[model samples]
Each structure stands twice: as structure tokens, then as C-alpha cells.
Target: MSAATLVGSEAPLAQTHDVALVDLDGVAYQGHLPIDHAASSLGAARDGGMRLVFVTNNASREPEDVAAQLSGLDIPTSPDEVMTAAQACAALLATRLEPGAKVLVVGGKGLVTAVERAGFVVVRSADDAPDAVAQGFSPDLGWGDLAEAAYAVAGGAWHVASNRDLSLPTARGFAPGNGSLVAAVVSATGVEPDSAGKPSPTMYRMAVDRLDARRPLVIGDRLDTDLAGARSGGYPGLHVLTGVSSARDAVLAPPGLRPSYLGADLRALLEPHPAPQRADGGWWRCGDRAARVVGDGLEVDRQGPQGIDVVRAACAAAWAAADAGSGPAPQGVADLSA
Candidate 1:
């Protein structure tokens, strides 16, 4: 079984976990701009002996491109150290089809290269009579590409999507990701493609195997995909507040989406995680803070310089309440931004 709630670590996570399957888009950089403290904290963790794998759901670019971008952002990554959903998706299709199978590619160079590397014949349209349609995210994709995918799927071709993430983080904001494109095909043909990206354990398992990591931790910003993938992959995950999900989201997450630890940013890797403990009056306490779910609300003890401990305690109390058949009041969680 997965850990029931947030877990404490005696040492920094970089020391505790042998490898980190780190998410790229939201956790590391938001649309090319690196998150604050990400590069330095990651460097510190690497210096402390933890191996890092850049596991990403974005299938728009190749691993080399991803590595270059990360290196440019001061993350100092290599192609071999990066894994893309396009690669995983191609590998998945390879298992389902024979070598040199005709696959209609619907993304960019990343997906095309991945399919080709998997020993498949990459085609462009449904007219190719492709055996499979490999769909991923690409900004240049248009109605013509989606139409071809729909036609292929409508003609009994197997549909494979890199991921099902509904949103992609960008410098401006969240944009429609691969999932949105997949949904269009699904809506047109009423055929849901098999997804091989996050929320599925395949990507995480692949990273674990490739890195030969005995103790792997998942680090991400989204609770629905990244954290959910960690739980399904049987790895502990840290939910950071750098991207999509909020602290209140953590407090309200169900078991499948709940994270093992929570932090404000990448710096969490260098600090010890304080476990929340049960205190008097049914409150959950962490560090110098305490919180308990009241009737449709939460009574939080606002101690500590930063309210991380209080946030931790609040999450614990909320989770405890949820496990017992009810969740903490929305009003209490409404402003849990810290």
C-alpha cells in the first residue's frame, strides 16, 4: 500500500532517494523560464549524490533539444539524462505492433524520431493506411493533422497518445497540451487512444529501469498527473507549489492523487521533511504549527515564520478527515496559498 499520508525524512531527499524522476514543464521551468531556486537547488542535490532524470510529458521536442534547453537554463543536463513522453509512447506502440509497422505520426520531430528509432515506418496521413496513429503535442499541428488522426482512427487504426495532460505550462500560461488534441480525435471517432504518459506508471517505471534506481522519488508540481503517477508507480512524490496545483489542492487530493511530501519549490530536496503528528483536540501538528478540521472549516494555528508547517499540518488534518468520510471545509482551504 502507498504511504497513508505525508512522510518525514531524517535527511535531505537528495540523500534519501537514490534517483529523482523529475517532471520538466511545471516543476523545472514554466515555458522556458526556469522556476526560482530550481537550478541552484537541483545542482546542490546533484552535488549531494542523487541522480536526476528529466522525465517529461511534453512530446513536442527531442531529448537533445530538451537537454539543450535545460543546459541553457543552467540545469546542466544531457540527452541521455532526459526522457520524453514521445519516446515512451513510441516504445509502447512498438510493443503493440511489429517492427517497421506503418505509424501515422501526428506530432513534431520528437514523435517522428521516436517512432523511427523504434523501427517503425513513419507516415503522415490516413491515406498511408497506417497501422497506428501516434499523437503527441506540437505547436505547429493544425486541423489537417487532427483530421488525419481522426480518419485513421475511424478506419480502425490503433490510436496512441503520448500523454493525457489537459494543460501545458508556458511562459504566458497554461495552453492546450497533447491531451486536447487527443480529445478532438476521441470526440470525432469516439475512440479513446491508449495513453503512455504520466498518470500511467509506464513512464515512471521506464525511468526507474533506465536509471537503475533502487530508491526513486517523483518530483512534480501537478497533483493530478505527476503525483498520481508516483502513487501508481509505487514511488514517493513531492508536490511543489511552483506550477499548477496549490496547497489547498494538496489538502483535498484523494489517495490516488495525494503526494508523499509537500514543499514550496525545488529547494525542498535539500531540507528535511517534517511529518505531521496527531495532537490534542484532534489537531495535526508539524513543527511549531497545528491544525484541525472544524465543522465545514479548519482551525489553523498560524505559528512558524513561514506557514509551511501549518500548511503541512492542515493537509494532514484534512487528509485524516477525508479518510474518515468527510473533507475539510472549503472555506478553510480557500486561501491556503502558502
Candidate 2:
């Protein structure tokens, strides 16, 4: 469905969609920490007959490790239920390269495992006369690693990157992700690597195919990656506020970047979503709140306790204004507090 025709679900989203292609880091857990209500909400969705697939751009860990980590967080998961960018990268490589082709790896064990599983021989240095180069993210990556990848790519080896996420969230803070390291190789060889992750429809399409899901909902925290990927793959996206994106971001989203649904957290999956309707005097009403685009700003009129409904109405008003060529809504236009 097109962004303009996007509407809220009258039924619980968990009952409407057969599968959920969920982003791991921000929507489920942040770094090693479990997000509030994530596990319980996910479990409830599972009980409601929705299959959950954890998707990640992090190529440092194997599926088993990722599943184990989720289990540790009290969210029971299996390797088959997880899809990594490394797997997507390897799957793409398999279609281009011949069987048993040697590929120079520049990341961690996860990348190596994915390549090997795809019937490609994993090599280390450029001296191996590699058929291609594959890169991903790893905590132990060093300057020496980027040099080898650059050398291989410069020597005519095809290059493929697991993902292009610029920054990764960690317990300490944001750190350089695979995309940052991939930039180094690009600078050295003046060549770009093919990516097989989010924002590129490949990973989402792969997950949908593997799950055999007729109806899938992509749930994520990042608009650029997860939600953008969902739009590219023709799937509805549910944006969560527990991670990087805020209500302000959603209200200001441009076409093709807007999510079909918005959630404060995973628990929104269990609740029916009310559609925002146009009211008199340029006002948009959603549930207990009404918002209007006044000049270049938004004004929210709450009829009940302040909640996500206010954000929904504000987004409707802002998007409507933008579509009418009224320009972007003013920043800090909505009273976000409860």
C-alpha cells in the first residue's frame, strides 16, 4: 500500500499479521540490555499465533549465539527464527560466485561461518587470490583488516558488505559499525561494496521467503533502516519509540520513510489502532486527541490522558499539511508529555 493511503488497524496487529520481522537491537533489546515490556509483549504475540523472526544487521555473532542471547533475556528463540545480514550477504554471494570460490573475509567468525555454509571457501589475505571479498562488523576489527579487504577489492575481487549501518549502539555508547569500516576500504580502493542488509530490500525479502509468510509486519525502531526496508519490500512497518526514533521524527517523516503503524513499544501489537480522521477546522482526531496544523506548527488538543494517540494525531496533521505543500511542521510542535 502507498504511504498516503496508510491507515491504522482496527484489530490487534498481532492477529492481523501472520509473522513479524522484528529488528533486534532497538525494538527488542538495546545492546545487552532487555527493553521494558519487550519479552512479555512478544510472548503474548506468539500466543496470539504470530510467528516472530529476529532480524539484525550485526554480523559479528552467529545465529546460535544470537538465539542464546535472546533466550538469556527470557525471550525464547531459535536459530532458524533469526536472520542476520551475514546470511543475506552470503546468499547474494552464492548467486554470483561459482561453487567453492575463495572469498577473502574481513570480519568476524559469523561472516566466515555464513560464507562457508554457502559453499564458499573463506580466505584471509589478498595473497590467497580470492574470488571476492566479504566484510562485516566485529569488535576486534583493526586497521590491518581493512587493508587486506582493500587490497583484495583493488585486485579485482568483487566486494560485498553485510550491511551499511553507520553506527552501532553498545552498552558504553554508539560506536563505529560495519558501514564505517566499509568506508575505509572504499576510500582505499575507490570501489563500493554491494550491501545485503536493511534499507536494501534483500534482507527483508529473504526473511519473508524463509518464513513463507503471506502477511508480514516489520517492527523496528529505526526509520532509515528497518522501516525503509519494509517500504521497499512492500510490507507494512510498525515503528517503535523504545529505541532511536522519537514521536517528533515520525511527525516529520517524508514520503517513503513513514511507517504504516506507530507503537510506543511492542505492547502496541496487542492493541487495536484507531485511525486518525479529519475534523472541522483543519483538525485531525485520533482516539482522545485532536491535532491541527496551524500555519507552520502543530497544536494538540487532548480530550483524555495524553498518550500515543496525541502523537498519531500530530503525525496525521503534519503529513496532511506537508502533502498539501504547507512545508514541514515546526519542531517541538506537540506536547509529548502525558
Off by over 4 Å in 1: 304-306
Per-residue alpha-carbon lDDT of model 1 for 11-90, expressed as tens digits? 98999999999999778898978789999999999998999999999888999999999999999999999888998998
* Best candidate, lDDT: 1
All candidates' TM-scores?
Answer: 0.98, 0.95
**Clash count for each candidate, listed in order shown:** 0, 0
Q: Residue-wise lDDT of candidate 2 within 27-93, one digit each (tens)?
A: 8899999999999999999998999999898887999999999999989999999999999989989
Error of 2 at 151 (Å): 1.3
